[model samples]
Target chain A: MRRSRKKQVIPGFGISMGVTLTLLSLIVLIPMASLVINASSMGFSTFWETVTDKRVLAGYYVSLLCALTAAVVNAVFGVILAWVLVRYDFPFKRFLDGLIELPFALPTAVAGIALTNLYSDKGMLGHFLGQLGIKVAYTRIGIIIAMVFIGIPFVVRTIQPVLEDMDSQYEEAADVLGAGRARIFFRIIFPEIRPALLTGFGLALARALGEYGSVVFIAGNMPFKTEIAPLLIMGKLEQFDYHGANAIALVMLAFAFLILFAINSLQIYYNKFTKQ
Target chain B: MKRKNLITLGIVTTLLAGLLTGCAGKAAEDADGKAAKAIEITNVSYDPTRELYEAYNVEFAKYWKEKTDQEVTVTQSHGGSGKQARSVIEGNEADVVTLALGYDITAIEEAGLIEAGWQSEFGNNSAPYTSTIVFLVRKGNPKQLTDWDDLVAGGVGIITPNPKTSGGARWNYLAAWAYADKAFGHDQDQILEFMKKLYQNVLVLDSGARGATTTFVENGQGDVLLAWENEAYLSMKEYPGEYEIVTPGISILAEPPVAIVDSVVDDRGTREVATAYLEYLYSDVGQRIAGENYYRPSNKTIAEEFKDVFNLELELATIDDELFGGWDKAQAAHFDDGGTFDRIYDGETQE
Candidate 1:
């Protein structure tokens, strides 16, 4: 195996690795390191105080709860959308596939303003909902709606390729074994797409956690209610409270890192178990 | 193969270096050409001043040309006042800053960009024009929100921006505070209660003044909007009879100040032009343009001329009054983290 790797097509492994590490450090690691350094420069007590302040804690709660809800929603719908696009031959399939990526292409602010306009109390759909005594905008529901809008593309794009690459032989064999439709999907197809779904779910979760633009517009930003962590950081910055902002941001960074790390470990463990 | 790779790397580096130098050379040439024919200055301002400055910039350029025999071009950058100040501090190369409040410019000054006593540099605390807070209600005064006390009355939904993020919203908060101070007879506890009730009625606390306007006027969510007098007028102009501006019995005198960023002007060799640009805002034409844009002119004569246009009868509170002290004290006491505003929401949420 070692000899085969050495004789592979791409040469200059050392040079390529050096370039990759340099670019990664320059583009990603350096800025993140500065954030950590800035946060740490404030004493631990101050950091703790800033992060644990009731308003900031409320912001974190709002952000985490809304992001989790949005990610879960995207996960369920995204899988179905990806499966349909990959498995079926339908009219406007290509157009629908393109449409799924609109959230990714449109500026988040534009998406936010457009969503706010459509969901405000006086808006087209909102008027009916208002008459029904349901308030969507300026509430937690609005925040989740904005997050889901920005997150759907992540889940769908991640799952679509895996679905397309999935082989049909497993399902056909399961069918030949007299398995029911639901059983075939649950036992054969689901297991194959589980890793992709998890990856998509993690990506969407991270994206929604940091979402600011669209969510802020629809959030109404009521403290202890609709204020998200990013807005808290912004509010701190607006007051020229740099140390406080960095502290809150550091806590959020740690949270996002832990979530992604746990998801990746779960995928690895699942992959190992399945292979065994 | 190694030799070929090295050759490719050498070519790429050479191209990148050549491209960078080529761009730098072009920029230098362009600067020299512009220096010979015209002087350019960038005026960094806050959001609501976009239209005001757009008109004023053209007027200033013409004035500069007539007086100095040199063509001048003015560039404008606008955003949330604090964000714009941070941009300048982070080296945005602003020659002049006409921000929404003195505190924002003070933030820039503390960053060592502008000289101290910048407020005293121009007339009226360096504020070319002034505006006050008022209510923008739906047509026919549906809620009849005539005063600040009525805002806290039952069934009246209010829309205002968060003071922490918006310079204009700080004025709005202070204006309400002033009203409460008078209404509650200088009793701190009663004023706090009044403020809490007023905020409780706020359906949407947007991040900026314009956003509050959108929440009130466009979204149709709130019964009344606490907005700048100029902003209220601009909304009426845009919507045409769909909204009405009600001058509250008492409000804050919102003085959006301007100043030349000393370090930047000295560095860029634009002190003279920048100073002239700001000073020109005090000129007669400048005052008229400000009044026409719905901002109450700081020039007493011009303000008198526009008396019919603006409600000059109401009592206006100044930030330097005994109640608030100054911007620094006001900010620390009311809008800072864990301050009165946050405490109000904190207590409400706990209940």
Candidate 2:
């Protein structure tokens, strides 16, 4: 007897694969390949020099650092936002939940300008902070704020569905069995949301890594100081130095892959741990 | 299922409630009725010039208002010049296009804004007003950046916008190329090599002139910020005690030209007023406002009057179609985002 086939969502395999391949080539492969081919014309030393340039290196550091910080901050708060929205009843609760996705919908430039205005030394809240000798608008701190502004939505969106689906019956049972709120949260709620948190973290990191518009204004784009990788690539392009831009882009692309890989492995480990 | 519907409704309501609300103020210009009495003119310019241009606009309105007794709205759309040009090319109704550089206008021409001989119609192959590219260094020259060579020096962090996509950035790139050719003597390889070093030193390449300035002055990232002379001057004027303008030893003269859209005005019977508006930009009052913004006035009398504020910049680096080739050639060979310059960064040119 023949084993049952893995029936799927769509029609026969060839048509689906044809569309998938066409999409992949058009959107990803062709453009990426052209970039690589163009970059290959540059001699290896030039490529090395471009990537190792002090300012480019600084940009790489800033891009990595800000993205990580934003991802971490988002993971924590995102979980709470999702948890509250799912498990609570309050006036205008829906409104507050909807606001979490604002960063996703708003133009990055508008967001950048708004954040810069609100946090600059002479900005609205910045005046108070400035009096306390706190510089927010034009620093690494400002970069993190911009990144978090964009990143929080990624995490919150990822976790909200999971929280919504969770059985509150299990939570109530745990409570009736005399378990404390904190313990019940840690043992029951945390494990269930772990998969989502991991997914959110990965998404947040990826989003932050590629972000340019929102952070550019707030980052102040200083070299060996606040310069970010995307900005470095931009600098390369402006000077009419295509290879330099590509070299920087290649490095960023590699770093992104490595980070995503690590994120995937972590996801795997979390899944295994949850299963156990 | 009813409970599920209720939950869906609740989710939708909450999503709406939770949005971070904001609004953008846009000038949806009423182009027709406003032009009935006074002439309506629009220019595609970069952001920093908005204030100066607006001053000219007010004066222009008054000049024409006195003549025609009409309500002329001299509206201006300001962004990076590249974007402005692209918008014009993509069919934004700009009657008179005054961009940060000629190349952007040329790009629009390629998109069929005007035929080949359009520049000569306004001013003989150049702009009515000319600005230069300069280095906006930190106060007191913290990184010791003085010239094009200094930008390539190890410690220098040069800030500029993307040349391939920004009109002002093309001037900055051309200035560097001009400097390199002058210093190293016009060997194609030497100029290319010098530019490669400079690119390596750039820490932040913002998308536009204002963005680059914000990167420099606000973020304090790059040691040297390549800026429009007028923009640098205006920005310093706006922010007292934040930065200093350091004109490079030799820099490219940026000619921001203006040409009335002959067809647009002729079709609408706005020729007299539109022509008057374009002419007004080169008049004494208009030139004074332009000078106030640090753009060198084309009108001779205006220049002489503002002599004290304006420096006689000598030993200037210049580019033309024959020497540097046009923007398309330069972009294809070196500046195009996907061309030679990108390849250099991609490690195709090293060693």
Candidate 3:
């Protein structure tokens, strides 16, 4: 009984898609493809050696572990911040909300430099923390702080809308049914927002993985200590070792892809589980 | 047609992305057609020393104003010394380059930016002013690190950038090598051992010279910092009472160089001005400024004027054009990112 006319939302979808595909292919896809292409310029043995090199390996571990930690922490604190914003009303609430975006607007280099100034032993925070025998700047801990500063907003913004749109009546209904606060939150609320949380985690993790500016100032860049993958890439380029630089970049790109793919799979599975 | 278009789009994007990301400065070829004939010379030099080097540019610009009627605008671009050189080679439009090391200039030459025998074009490899490898110690020498051996004496964290990536760090690395070569008899293995121990003492390797300085001066992580004499002097001057430059009994002589990128200058027709700029650096007027900047003049009296605070006698390293077999081989072998430093860390840290 239904006549199916063309259901295209826009008549120019194909043309736009073509343009988009072309633009993305140039800006994102091709340069990324070159990471692998340039790396392939070297022999397999040389590639293996470069990949397995101690400094490069250290960079890998540092990047992944720090990114993972940052994302996980962002998920926790981001949810907390979102929950606070959504669940409560206080004076300067708009100001508080605006402040959460400081990291997003602040240049990572400036952030790194500022964080270094703040947490250095001679810095104000550093002076106090140093009295207690804790060092932040120029340590892996400094890297974590830098990552956290950059990663927090991704999770906060992602979860904030979900929290705001969340059905408050469900909690009120659960209260009416004699369920406690914790039980209502876990059984009723968390399941509804799991997808958004995963989306935030993926974005945060990816952002942290490729972070160079903030990490560089605080990292202290010691080989096999704090030197990161981006820094290693820079080192290669500085020496005019273009092939070497590209090889290491390819490794980073591969790892970034792997992490993103894994996160996407998890997000998909979570959606399926929740649906069922 | 669709597939072919996709492929073409991909290639165009790749080139565009490279251009965007790399962002080569072509010195904006003199298309101004202004009232006064203007010559734009792109000066690619290393930074943190930018403030001091800009003074040189101002002086040179003044000389041109007095000597000729051409409007010369010298654009000074700076970063890590070695990185500046690489940028020039990759097409940054440097009519003249004054980098922090010969290896970087050598990189420019290997890329055919200049003639094959570019080193012979200037005296002492075009090194304008010399500095010695020294330690940027904490105020009052808390850990009492006197020399390279003291750097490995445990619980003493040293901070320096990667030598492979930084010209100043190369001087720091070569200084350590020179020390090991003298004390333990310069075996490659011994050189490796010393560098390994030195690394073990390092808290972190920063990305650039300024980063390393921050690691020591601001961050307060490292007890001892290997820094350029000029950088160390500037740090002491800037931070005042926060840090001091300690020269070891014998230290590596660090020479920072300048050169004309022959290909670029010849094309731009700025060769006369470029030649005048570099040659001016050797004159008494230039040498005095160089000495004031803590870059030890090749002239001995200029070295002594800054000598009241300079306690460490120079036991200079054996780095020359022949020793490193020019910058090409060095770039291919030791100083390149994945070369010895990367390989060493690769081998050492994998365990």
Task: Specify the highest-TM-score model's number.
Answer: 1
Candidate 2 local lDDT, B93-210, one digit each (tens): 7888887766677776766666677778765354767888888877888777777787888877788876644677878888887888888877977877788888877766566788
For model 1, what is the alpha-carbon lDDT of residue A27? 76
Proportion of native contacts found in each model? 0.49, 0.11, 0.64
Q: lDDT at A14 for candidate 3?
A: 45
Q: Model 1, residue A218: displacement in angstroms?
A: 0.3
Please say which candidate is ahead in TM-score: 1 or 3: 1
Q: DockQ rank, highest first?
A: 3, 1, 2
lDDT of 3 by residue, A1-276 (tens): 012225454555445556688788668998888777788889899888877776678889888888898899989999899999888999999999999999999999999999999988889998899899998887788888999999999999988998899888999999999999899989998987777888888888889988999999988776666777888787777767788788888888778788879888988898788789
Model 1's i-RMS, to one decimal, reads 5.0
Error of 3 at B23 (Å): 15
Tens digits of per-residue lDDT for model 3, B225-317: 898888898889998998877778667777777789999988878899999888888877777788778777766676677677565366776
Cα lDDT of model 1 by residue, A104-208, tens digit: 899998888788888998998777898999989998999999999999988999889888888899889989999999999899988888998999999999999
Return the TM-score for candidate 3, rounded to 2 decimals: 0.89
Candidate 1 residue spans exceeding 4 A from truth: A1-9, B1-25, B347-351
Query: In DockQ terms, which candidate is top?
Result: 3
Ranking by lDDT: 1, 3, 2
